[model samples]
Target: MSNPLQLEVERLLALGRTPEALAAGEAMASDWARQGQPLRALALCRVLLQLEPAHTRTPQLLADLYARPDAPAKGAPPAAAATLPRVPLFSQLGREPFMALLGALELRTFKAGQNLITEGEPGRSMFALADGQVDVVRLLEGGERRTLASMGEGEFFGEIALVSESPRLASVVATRHTVALELIRTRLERIALRYPAVGETVRTFYRERLLANVLRSNPVFTTLPPEQRQALARCFELRLVDAGTVIIEQGQKGDGLYLLLQGQCTPVLRHPDGKQSAFSSLREGDVFGEISLLLGQPASATVRAETPCHLLRLGRDAFEQNLASQPRVRAALMRLGTERLLHISKLLSGRAALEGDLRV
Candidate 1:
């Protein structure tokens, strides 16, 4: 389906309403960024940059948006522990284990403007900043550079890549002469296997980070207090489903609510007569299956992954056990469900009207 915002921007641009289109695009981009969907925000920014290449503020805005801090990951705890410092990932370990981890780390330095990690390169290890600063920049299509963030003393980067054994999402460059301690995955794995406590600490930290990001991204969870959000986060189970997988079949009993952390899915309604129509798409930060879960009814539509999806699922039992005490969350979910139902009603009405017009 065509994006209403994009269509509006295009219409304005066709009418030579450059200023209006720019303003609209800027507002939409800011909204998307606030909703924690950076890629969508960046897409809007790209359009604005393309139309107004000379607009100085657009580039700066893109940079600022990119520079917004992500949920903190495992990092060095303190500089007083050892030469490498006490990182949270090793916080629970005894002195011997901690020292062992510290010994495994290799201290590295880079000159100003030197790249410590490049986008799309395999990440074999994670790094903890010991001194100086590093800038995280993502290269966009057509060779544009967007600065994602900056890191200083004790901050961690590349942990996600290391954990998932995936390519780096962005490049990390030394903004100045910098010192960092590199933790190779293999060494870390060995330490973790030998010390279950160390492994659990890292796992807990990563899970918390994932939960925090999902909570921040999703509008329904935004109203939840930090403590409550943390409580709810612990109740979720992470699942990775492959592309084209049907997650929730239409008319099936809904057992849980799902929060999409990464990738996209489409909610499609299938009629008994074998007709199917996708009404909307869900991307990162979007929640689904809540309607059925809350109402204790069958799912109204099928949800299929459009890409490999990373999801956090909160089953009804967990929701009742963990979230029932939070009246605010319950109220929020009810309100969201109402809004979603209304949206579906509108979509159906619009389709019916179009069908009627076509028949005439």
Candidate 2:
């Protein structure tokens, strides 16, 4: 720590201006880290301990600056506590914790046509748009990308990155010059260490937001009332699987209903005679395990993940409690099961015809 800067910060503490003292210390530390001087950064840590260890921002500040060797060089510029306007996304956070989280957010600027988040990339942070506009998009099986929504100021996206280590579910591109605040993954982890409730709130908020969207759009769930859908979303537990992992094996008992929220899967049909065939790929908004659940039979096919997947599973009891009363939902699900069964027949018939042609 530089003597002049250290002395000024100590003076603030002595004058009972504790918040000012922490701010000054944090700024000095940030500057030292930005300068890429490890010794100066380390010295500030000791000074923070001596001055006022109880309320020091040293841990978070140091973690932010030097946690990863490349963090200082590649990280976004730090944002002040009061930098962002009223963001409704953080509205769930209490005043004190929200302020703390706000201070951790970094300022990011993007030009028009810049990619904020890319589909299928590792996501370590989420963003809150402070100004300008962005488009959220998803990739289709046809190798085309579709805009899911256009967001302007006060909207936030990428919350799932904070909770799940899976790849990003979609991409966000700036439509114009944009200013946003980014809350990185590690900082949120540290904050969660200090504020458990804050961590739960964020995790819960992400889950509800993620699953609620699925429930609203899914045809089987659409017949249920909104409140029921929300309640049903809560009943479903999140499950993630890496590429090539078999979600359900052929001829096995189904767990319940699994709604694919992100990524793709392929249903592999294994015949008793040892031939295997993969049916069409299953993408977002596709649901599986329903055939077994609805008919009380073993799964008809093996489902394997084609990519890193995020899924929500409703257990047998929960599925019954939630959808058993809804006749339309059950009927719709039954129809889907019948269609899948027909698809299975068609695949088997195609393979048999190919074998017969080869014999001919």
Quick one: best lDDT, which candidate? 2
| Model 1: lDDT of residue 351 | 47
Candidate 2, residues 1-360: lDDT per residue as tens digits? 124433543465575535566577667766765655433443444445555646445545544443322323235345432332323444455545554665567657687899999988988998876556899999989999999899976667888888776678788999977766678989999988887877877867777887888878888778888888888878888787889998988888998898888888988888778898766678887888888989899999999999888888899999989887789999988988887777677677763322221100
Q: Which lDDT tens digits does candidate 1 get at residues 189-281?
A: 898788676676666666677779779767677888888888888888878788899999878998888888767898887666676767557
lDDT of 1: 0.67
Residue 330, candidate 1: C-alpha displacement in angstroms: 3.2
- C-alpha root-mean-square deviation, each candidate: 18.7, 12.1
- Provide the overall lDDT of each model, using Cα atoms, as 2-decimal numbers: 0.67, 0.71
User: Model 2 lDDT vs. the true structure?
Assistant: 0.71
Model 1 has how many clashing residue pairs?
A: 3
Q: How far off is model 2, as Cα RMSD?
A: 12.1
